[model samples]
Target: MDLHYVVQGNGEPIVFLDSGGADLRDWEFIAPSLAKSYRCIAYDGRGAGQSPSPIEFGDYVEDLKNLLDFLDIDNTVLVGHSIGGRIATDFALTYPQRVSKLVLIGPGLTGYQFSPELVQRFEEIQSVAPNVEKMAQLSLELPSYQVVMTSPQRDRMVEMTKHNTLRGLEWQHLWKNLQVWGELPAIPPLNELRVKTLFIIGTQDSEDCFRIADLFKQVPDIRFAHIEGADHMPTLTHSLEVSSIIREFLGESKL
Candidate 1:
């Protein structure tokens, strides 16, 4: 769909994927620092930012493929946050030769189900879906977002949340058959993944996500970092620490 994207710096390319209901700005802090040594590309997913509303589950994956082809980027590192991480995982599985490595932060997994209470909250969020601002505000109040964000960072998050919320409202009714979760038929067996992988999560993030982290133990050549006192949005709340860890991983992975 000709997704909106921005590219900076040079050298080995690193593509940044945003969380669900988020845009390229999700990497605002981390991308710039990495760009000093690597080409950093951040893009809006279908139905988010300036990208068009998604018509099917495969749309996000296709958009990414098209973007990479257009840029003539190959064997790039993919860094993704939340649902963005899930998309990266799927892309790597589908096009392993195109990906050199993966860095997944608070990634979602196929077949992962939300707890009953969380499902209720999801319904509540959808109930207020028509009011994008209210939905965004409520989302910020969720426990996952209530930790460690500075005022300015929180404001930026709210802005991105609202933008995504509005797009979702515009698309959901028309694309009701599209499955947001479980875009993959099943989680690919981790042992089959050939590229080096890093999984980072915040101790204070969702317990469900922590469970998903446990599944990654099966992945060969995988490294993990657990950030203390941070939450779901650590890329925003703990940008410096996250960036440092990524730089170290890149250097060590090269060796």
Candidate 2:
């Protein structure tokens, strides 16, 4: 596979999917801790980091499948954050048997409608366009990132996001103009989710993230947890807590 991926330890496989505008390194804190117990694979999604850009809208999902196939993984545990959580959810819904358990941190839902204000915020970011530095600054200014913006991880978050924006704008501009992605397979309703899941979010996260958490209530086998004093980038600020919760959820699966 052309996607850049990192693998560690050895046991039941655990693949980490990261948020938009951030690469596999976003999982730097928690993935290694989990790797000590179970095999962990963290990859830069197509167009995000070292991976090349996608030729189509839904390539992220298929690229993930291909990555697993390349690694000879029959099934795996998925750990995803933000948009990464959205990808993981879509992957599980599309290939139920391939995912054993899910750990989604402040995930985004494919079919869910976002609020006008949040939508406008992103639109403003896009309006800046070719000025990637301004685009990157506007992105991190969202209240959803307030907590992490004030934390020690602030610099790292800024660096990764700016780098992603610089490398990805061209690809994003191409696909956003084509708009063929909306024609892809529809995501089933939240209740139709088949994989057992652990949904965690920071209490300080945006209202929309909490709203999405409420939506997960439709999934029968889901559990919820909150990390105190954290916002969207808990993997950077609350690594120990995130890792511990994931380990507890997986329980005896670590062989």
The true-versus-predicted C-alpha distance at residue 80 of model 1, in Å, is: 0.7
How many residue pairs clash per model?
A: 0, 0
lDDT of candidate 2 over 111-162, digit per residue (tens): 7677779878877887788798899999999987898899899999999999
Error of 2 at 130 (Å): 0.9
lDDT against true structure, model 2: 0.88
Q: How does model 1 fare in lDDT?
A: 0.84
TM-score each candidate: 0.92, 0.94
Predictions in order: lDDT: 0.84, 0.88
Residue pair clashes in candidate 2: none
Please give, for residues 144-208, the per-residue lDDT of candidate 1 as tens digits: 77784454587788778888888888777775564544443666787777789999999889877
Error of 1 at 208 (Å): 0.8
